[model samples]
Target chain A: MKIGIIGGGAVGLLFAGYLGQKFDVTLIVRRELQLQSLLMNGITVHKGGSSFTTRVDSDLLTEVSMKFDFVIVAVKEYDLKPLEKVLELMDKNQPLLFLQNGIGHLEWVESLPHHNLLAGSVEHGALKENDHVLHHLGVGKTNLALIKGEWGAVEELVSQSIPSFPFLLKQDFEEMLLTKLFVNVLINPLTALTRVRNGKLVENPHLHQLQRDLFQELLLLYPHMERNVSFEGVVEICNNTYENRSSMLKDIESERKTEIESILGVLLEKAQREHHFVPIMNVVYRLVKGIEREGLGG
Target chain B: MKIGIIGGGAVGLLFAGYLGQKFDVTLIVRRELQLQSLLMNGITVHKGGSSFTTRVDSDLLTEVSMKFDFVIVAVKEYDLKPLEKVLELMDKNQPLLFLQNGIGHLEWVESLPHHNLLAGSVEHGALKENDHVLHHLGVGKTNLALIKGEWGAVEELVSQSIPSFPFLLKQDFEEMLLTKLFVNVLINPLTALTRVRNGKLVENPHLHQLQRDLFQELLLLYPHMERNVSFEGVVEICNNTYENRSSMLKDIESERKTEIESILGVLLEKAQREHHFVPIMNVVYRLVKGIEREGLGG
Candidate 1:
């Protein structure tokens, strides 16, 4: 199987290295420097204090002209609009997998001409150390659900997955995405605003109370969220990633646009539509949006 | 007229310097170092481009004795509990004017034996420069209203007020305090949590909308708040104090206990009692409280 991954963020590099192990994978990086480096030395992934380099084909995003069995859209939500032309040019039968953080891209994905669509929530913690070096901080399962089209395409893609970078098939699309969204909504913005690591929210009594309140209020919107995921499970995730700064926090520090709109922004709109009162969420939404508008992040 | 001002924070020092111009005023400060300096150099007031020094009487809070016409309690709400013994020692008949930021001190003041009670909403912006110096940043009036006292006592107190620090008497106590409380509730906690100056709350579009939502929600509890204060007035206050850091923001920066409980805490309690929903306030309250617990402030 030949796979082409678009965009060269941490997630893009991570997918390229792992999928390159078994399948014919080509990484379409936006930066020329990163593409040159990957072409010269291949993609290097660091995990468990050991480093492995995978010889993956590389090309600039604009230079990619060949057909592939699948294309994984691994860019941020804000970066989605600019890729409309690229996505429109792709083959309708070639299944496109999206790995964005929030559910904000659902409407846009539905509008695309692609008939075979799959959405994924990446649990793996990947950070880009440089242009070509990707650090796989934690090993977590990537859950994939079919947003539209048949599951036969997904089965073909799954057969190519290696044991190390495992992908799990979820039955429900909304539940799979909502579970990840709920956790991200509760954790990311708070850590980014407070500029603290994940564990501090659960370790500090007052912060913990806030987390409880925010979680309780969020559950009101999707009470079924607890059926699939427990409050303890969310806290456990925070404890496991205790020392790690959340991606939202890292984006704010690096002055990159955050996925707040896809995360908290979508939730706020839903609250308004449902006419449900969520005070805690409203405050956080405004605060994060305020920081973004004030040029802390675009 | 003679008066004793308790607590040597910005408010206490502001009252001491202004009232010292006309009345035989004595400042009761907690710090022995501040007492020694005030004793040696008197109280200095810096306003506009000019500066003036007044020979005001100074004494340690532990050593305050003799009879005074009235005692003005100019301390934070958190500091009120520790001063129970000091308040008990004062003459009960003497009018005690309490100048606090929030409505949290309302219950504590009602528990005191003083029948001649008054409340004042201080509008002036004062910053403590040193042990004995205070810079008066803005010229605004002090609105006083009788909480449990006759107009005779307030008349005597107002007569001694200087022109720069004029005191204006209002008819209703709740209306007077609630107006100031409304502005404070909308500004203080948000600024402190975001670590921005007072003006940023209004200047930032997202923050301003959130402020509007919180203000609209808080008004349900006290519908009469807008009769004396307009929403524009609160925005004006933010614009006027654009460069000045709020006392709450300053407290958080200095790692001292913030006045959040006194401000937002009281409103949250009232929301519970009245069954009025205040979502944004609840979230901001928890965040500020969390930061306080983490010892960014007490």
Candidate 2:
């Protein structure tokens, strides 16, 4: 089955770069500059000292070429609506997988009458160098679990295309998605507001206590959640991701609307609906909202 | 009557610059460079945007051309012993004024059987520009208090010299020294370690609460003690010197052996002596000691 990747940022381009060689792939980038640049320089995937560039066709994304077997949305969470309208034009039988950090996408897509949407999580610290360039600063597993059917075929494709990196096909979809959401809520808002790196948290006892506070509050609200499998038993991922900017931190640093809206923002709403008090998360949400209201990211 | 000024640092040089006009003065500096610089260029007082330079003989200190009627020891409190040895060569009938912050000078000088040791408190923020130059940043007041016999003549002389600025004839020498000690404990450690200016304290609520905790703890131990005096209703003299760097901050920034040993270190010792646990001060002392041990200033 042919795969079509939507969005042309690091996440989108990296996926297209990695999956292009194994399958029939076309990268759907919105801007003419991105398309032109990709056509000229290809897409650079930098890992360690090695780098590779891949060719992508932008024209295949128009409603005319909406024939792919799978569609992956790779934009920041707030930019999902316009592309969701475009995804409306695609074949409804094809599976849709979201590779964003936050939980709102699952809710948004689930609200629509789509039969084949998959909740996915990528802990990969993929950083965008430029319009058509990327850096994989950290290697986190890509978990793809179907909300409806078995992911055996997807697993086969992933196993065939695996490049010495970890990928997973888990059956417990909602809990897996919630676990990733828990990790995002705990780390992203904290690192964003405090302007500290992953390594710096352990240096300050106050911040370490803050991390535990967020964990306790999240656990109290969503007790059914499993610890983040990527970061849970594997205790060293946080230290390893030292000095590497979280995408939310990068958003705040670059003066862009952060994924806090999808992560903590939606969780706050859900907590209110469930009649639960999350003091720690409420603090993070309010601070980020104040930052956004001040036109900080505008 | 003749006077002798000890230490070639800014404090000694500044007093020498002004007091040289008032009395026949001799400045004793340890370093040959400082001694030669003062002898060649004269002590320059950069006060109120105008420069006043005054010349004094270098050999008069040892040549015994005149006997000292007053001696002002203005070195860092740590180097008190050399001044003690120098005192052996001087006339024993003179009154000595200590122009240093913190409380240990009283104990050290009290150990000597001198004729009279008058305690003086100067809140002037001065920086050593060069060996022979001093920059007086802020002008608060110098309070001269007599610790021994007949305060009548000394008070009149100090009152007549600076009738314009706020100078006090503080009879309560112990209270006056303790007042300066208490204020330095708060202002110096907070500003220097945090590397924050006085006004910047208002920006962070966390830091503000920490200040409150420290203040409240000090209040618990010493009830009804008000070091916070106002020329017009303001408590801290530090607020008057807002933009100026505290001497403690300058010491830390310049990587010098801090007066922390005499300041907070003495406070901790005093608290232990009184059998009362100063929780906040203990924390501050430990934190500063940790900073000193870590060579953070380096």
lDDT of 2 at B224: 54
lDDT of 1 by residue, A1-298 (tens): 8889998889999999998888899999888988889989888999988999999999887878848888898988889898888878777888888998888888989888988888999999999998789899978989999888876556866776778898999988788988899889878988877777898889877677878888887888888887987778889999999988999888877766788899988888888999988878878878877776665732
* Model 1 chain A: worst 10 consecutive residues (lDDT sum): A289-298
Fnat for each predicted structure, in order: 0.70, 0.00
Q: Among these predicted structures, which one has the highest TM-score?
A: 1
Q: lDDT score, residue B270, model 1?
A: 88
What TM-score, over all chains together, does every model reach?
0.90, 0.61
CAPRI-style class, candidate 2 = incorrect
Q: What is the C-alpha RMSD of each candidate to the true structure, in Å?
A: 3.1, 7.7
- Distance from true position, residue A18, model 2, in Å? 7.0
lDDT of 2 by residue, A53-157 (tens): 877656434543777778777777888887766777776777777787767777677775556778778878788888889997787778887877445346656
DockQ of each: 0.46, 0.06
In terms of lDDT, the poorest run of 10 residues in model 2 chain A is A226-235
lDDT of 1 at A193: 75
Ten-residue stretch with the least lDDT total in model 1 chain B: B289-298
